[model samples]
Target: MAQKQNTLRVGLVGAGIGGLAAAIAIARAGADVTVLEAAQELGEIGAGIQMTPNAARLLRAWGVDKVIGDNLVRFEELNLRRKDGTKVGGGPTIRVEKTLGQPWWLVHRAHLHEGLVDVARKNGCDIHIDSRVASISYQTPGPVQVQTERGATFSFDLLIGSDGVGSIVRRTLFPSVKPSPPTTNCAYRAVVPYSQIRKDPSLVELVSKPTMEVWMAPHAYIITYPISAGKDFNMVLSHHRPNPVIAVEDVDMNDFRNDYRDFDPRIRKIIDMVPTAKRWPLLVTGPLDTWSSPQKNVVLMGDAAHSMVNHMAQGAATAMEDGAFLGRVLRETVSGRLSLAEAITIYEKSRMPKAYFKQQVSFLNGYIWHLPEGQAAINRDKAMEVELKGEQPMRTPNLYVDPTTVLEVYGYDAEADADEAIRSFLEQHESKDESTGITKKEADKILNWFLPEEERFLIPSKF
Candidate 1:
């Protein structure tokens, strides 16, 4: 007779997007999940987030799409231009949805966070906002133990560090790992009301429809898109500096306008209309040798595992992917099909290389986009122009429109990939033993577990 398996208890640090996402995914898979956040209140500080198809599909599966409600903006077109408003590249993103089976979305960071939190709670996640982690014990333990700053202690079968760039859980697990160094790049983020944008005839076109626009220049670029259901225009302005401080501080409006003084007149007007903005110093962490403790019970996910700059606009998307993938693999462990160690091994093996690749690509994208005015920049512009005109199927300098990159980045299916990995592992390990060998019946059960009825998880359109 087989022993009855108890539900897996998962302790997750951080209640941010990634943590909440993990909570929802794991809880839905029958794990008892608890989330601890350092902040007294749950919220996000950024202006807007680009929820690409890869992450959007996971959100849809977890029913967070419905929770987003009126805050979601589905844009199908992106326009890329030079500093003087010369159109360089960009086109319709409708093909992306058609190819990838999910639509790209834009939303305020706070709104998305709220939606994730709501769905996580509905999925039975016990989230404690004021519980700051003081220390963690995983070195010699049957279960990982966490101590909060308030002297409260909790133990769990698994500990996930989904905490942001500064992750205490990660630090505890890997004492030798150093903090991410500050870069010479920084970004200013702000949200302008559509009503304010309407005041200027030149800006009215920007809000007339759901679209994304990027104006590129030497060592700087400005990206804008509609958020809050087209009621607001979110702007992210990236630039270089000789000495950039690592902090989020209020921008000096005068200095901010002067920095982009050479841009188009319309851009200058838009900058002037901005009442306030916050400057965020870009920081990135190099790939670590591993993202798991020696015991494998304690692991890292999201930014805690692979923090990258926002150059690719994939920082949040990749974090969501990490959470989703972890949840999928851990489900097998909960079902007694795989050990916790085996599940963590699969996760580390599959996610580490992909996440590290994205990190390097994102860093390289920053260099590409911030090239000085020279032959390199001109060649980049010419390539984008040719690609936009459909003259050839060759790779474009703009990653957003590059066919290969678009497919690789947006067309990924985390659940499917995890299922395949599980299948391969079972075939290799379980097939060797006659008693433990996977039978047809067992394989069918695993397939069913991976592919639940689509209708059961579909988000309603009128939610």
Candidate 2:
């Protein structure tokens, strides 16, 4: 396929979900997209990921949803319980779908990655595996250049750093920025096959139908949901790290069992069923002061931009939103209506506040979910109980049912937000037409560049 006229040559580092999502969105917007992956092969190593409505909307738009098809499980509800199986709060998620026009989904991370890879390739993205970026050059009057470890060099008009938490691209952009200190929390992840869950009567309720179950207690919480179309049950247990060293390692089964031994009996049963589990020390990077370089040619996305605590489970979703918004804004550059610098600035301006908000909220949620057995915990439970009993619609401790948070997080539309930002940019620049040379007619055209509503949600046939 021929490249679109005046389209950007985008070199994106990282082929993880965020990178691939950006590649797909950019390629779909008629840019030449090349993705560089450090790994020897393409795949995700994690167990499960929650696809909130915000992320799910982008997946459907990119035609990735169909590619993910049966691998996804659309969960009906979220159940929030005390550590000892006492119900606290959480309600059906069906209303989220109704309110947002997108369903909340759960899927194996590998399946989601595969689907994104397939859709990205179908959309004409070039993905190079085993192509670790060794260095990047940001020359003022020339294209940004990237050198791979294997001695191959690639050049592009724009460079996106989606390389994750330890992003080399990010370091090159802001070398003066210091690394964030590791948090005290660590997470243990495991998957129990649905067959195993079904064999035991005590665990059958977990897989009988799809639901997200969260058991919260002082200094710890465990979240479980069905994945791989309900063929497996995925669990994440977050707790205080016994060892101060921050790393991902195998946890001894006995130690893992002992950690949650005092919790619900059914949880202990699930823990006993697991053969092994991996403990990952939770780490956070910037809610950085800036995500783009001084030149505006190099920018960061996803975890590279802001890797926060996983309490809100919006890390990947926000990254996907970044991809969607970048794609939308860059279309102006592709159409010659906005300069590369202008588009990048608009993207940073539009996305950073919300991304920062999410980062803080995720951190706040960590504190809320792991409250100790005290007056604060009691108050939280009472607020959640009131919401659960339909007594009030005010903000509650339960994020799933928190009206303001749910609307702000799940009902977000990246493309729509981008359009609004672009309009704002045009309006602001148009006021200085004598200096900027942006005529009213040109601004109007740019304002109306969005796709028709009828065609907006249509997936590509190839997908």
Candidate 3:
């Protein structure tokens, strides 16, 4: 089987980073694609979204940097601290873009989204607003139909569920399951103007320039970095909780004076500086039993696949890397000698193990974040002691599988690969078919066989 063009059509069910990136990838591959978003306006709020070295390479290819040139900022260092604002560890930050032969940048969430949308449409994807993906059916040779919220029905060569954790596409295809519960942890998210916080002697160190800072406290952590150049700061405060999941929309920023009372005095000062905030209850997703639909044509991606705790900051980055890799896998399978099943097989075989490893690592990090109060103090003291004794500072471990190592994933161009994959997929399907077209029994066999016994759900690169 070789790549074929039978109108390589794709239906994407989300307009966030994953869906948008996939749209750019597939459309670049010369496939006709449609991106659907449930929200009337698909944009994330203000913040510094970091793109590590690995993921940045693909963005360079997608022209993300040039699109957000002035709006994005690059961090110059990574600094760590003890709970009470005591300096515990420090080091020169690796310039992700320079290290990986691409640009690593931070931008307001809205800016990144708008840039991606613009490029996606420029590349020829049909993006629809407020067209929620209600249900997906794939009783046909490929993805058969997708029913929309507006009572619209459409068919495509493939249907991708890039929707978030509550993916309706996933719900309709897989068995019913309850949502993940809060883990007694929560994050206070804020996007504040640089001009305001820049006045605080302690806080000003953060945004008077471009850098990423992680101030660890006895029971919680604070992260702040530049996004959209020096225009704003993306700040988040995480706390140790027997439970931490607080929905952002449900939060009252004014009450935090009490919420963080027992913690470090410096943290209280930081909280006071934050005039507005969103609360997101930290929730942990159990390891997915499997992520593919019975049809195999409809598979989950990004948070819909595996939503991880933000401990690693690889959530969105992971999704971007996944999109690039997915495009690569298709390109490899279809453009060359493998069948469609063969192509997907290559993809799962290559990606599942790594994805599973990262998922488990996220779980482990969550355990670290939830270290018991007294135990947390002990660990902090130990870390602090080591820093003092060694006369050297501790560094942030690459808790993530660096996105830059993905020469095998996003490195390959989606267009060239898709051209090849389409032919290969079609040939394989053609070889297995009869003039009478697919018989019911044969169709069932194909569907069942293509439906992997188990598939790993992957999230974004801090994606």
Candidate 4:
């Protein structure tokens, strides 16, 4: 019989959102899990993150919502408008909650990070700070070893790379892969105290209720919403340029103000009040040919696997989904029901399609939001108006900002999908094996789902 999965020792690189969440998830699956972080302190930046119902449901199930506290602001709508504040189009977020059974939440990044960290500790996950992973070496059919910058080595049954876009783990596994530069856009982010906003009547009206205010223009857009229980307002101004003259990190307040000179005066006032801002260059990576190491004992998760432009705001949520589903797969492996290799295979098949689909849509969203002045942009606005107002017949579809589109994306449950994948895996293998379990052919079929026809010949014949 295979060893019980609870006996598995797992090591995770990076203690960011994805790693911490995965640590809690792996621990819950009855494994001994350790998270290594290069950062000296476990803290999140002061930016904001949106947690749609799909992700919020998982966090609630993991008991993270309670610790997230009342500081979370729940919203019922995402309003899209012109730079002049003219309503263009948007969807009712409450309708999503009604359909999906969980409310959408907006939160400060630090708050969400804190909640995950607290729950991870409660679940008995050993998180080591400042332990930078230098390299990973795996002896197939044996344990995987991780070397840290401090010259210490740790052995584990499996390794997970959650180390953001610039993942050393990913680099060690596939040295040839390189992430693309900024995709013609950068975001300037800032948070303003609600006190300052409330003093201005226009800003007060905007924040009187929980809403996602999106202002779209020809070559730019702005997203603003309340976070930290309305204690502060989060703003992200995204601009598109064919040839960006300055690095995103070097963008200053003057540059930010200049970009939005034509925006609504009221909105500009909010920008002026922001003491400082951080600029982030939007980055993306093409879908990988494979997400696991050659031994299949190590896997990449979150941004390391699919670092997408944040046009759709699915970056963090998708990372959470990856952790949740991985937890489920590990649970099955820990129970001695499946081999580690088989479990990771199922995890990849179950996750890659969904994640890649999200990445594609996220890229498309950037195009839609920053459409240049043309007939296409006008038609897009008209379609959104029709959808938002419930006017006219079913007509053409607005794939970008419609409520149905939102529902289709946020309605997914990663845990549920994982359960289905496991069932399929068992059925496929059990049917193929007379008494000796999966045959080489059956195992290859299960493992080579994403490989090309010519490349599928490489899987070894032995188990």
lDDT of each: 0.83, 0.86, 0.63, 0.82
Best by lDDT: 2
lDDT of 2: 0.86
State the weakest 10-residue window (summed lDDT) of model 1.
454-463
TM per candidate: 0.91, 0.91, 0.79, 0.89
Clashes of each: 0, 0, 52, 1
Question: What does the lDDT come to for candidate 1?
Answer: 0.83
lDDT of 4 by residue, 386-458 (tens): 6567443243234423555666678888888889999878876654444545554655767667777775534
Q: Report the Cα lDDT for residue 346, model 3.
A: 47
User: How far does residue 409 in candidate 1 sit from its true spot (Å)?
Assistant: 0.8
Model 3, 1-463: lDDT tens digits are 4555445667889999878987887777566889888889778654667665555666778887678778867776665655555665544445333434555566677888888888898898998888987777786665569888899888876677788677886687665743464456667777767777767777655555677666655456777777766777777777644543534545566665566676556546666777767667555443566666555677667777766677766667667766776676554434454444555554444445555555666655555544555865566446544433334332322222223323322232333443455455445555333343544345455454555544212211222
Distance from true position, residue 329, model 2, in Å?
0.9
Query: What ranking of all candidate models by lDDT puts the best one first?
Result: 2, 1, 4, 3
> lDDT tens digits, residues 121-188, model 1?
99999999899999898877588989999999999989999997789988887766754534678889
Model 4 poorest 10 in a row by lDDT: 392-401
Candidate 4 residue pairs in backbone clash = 5-334
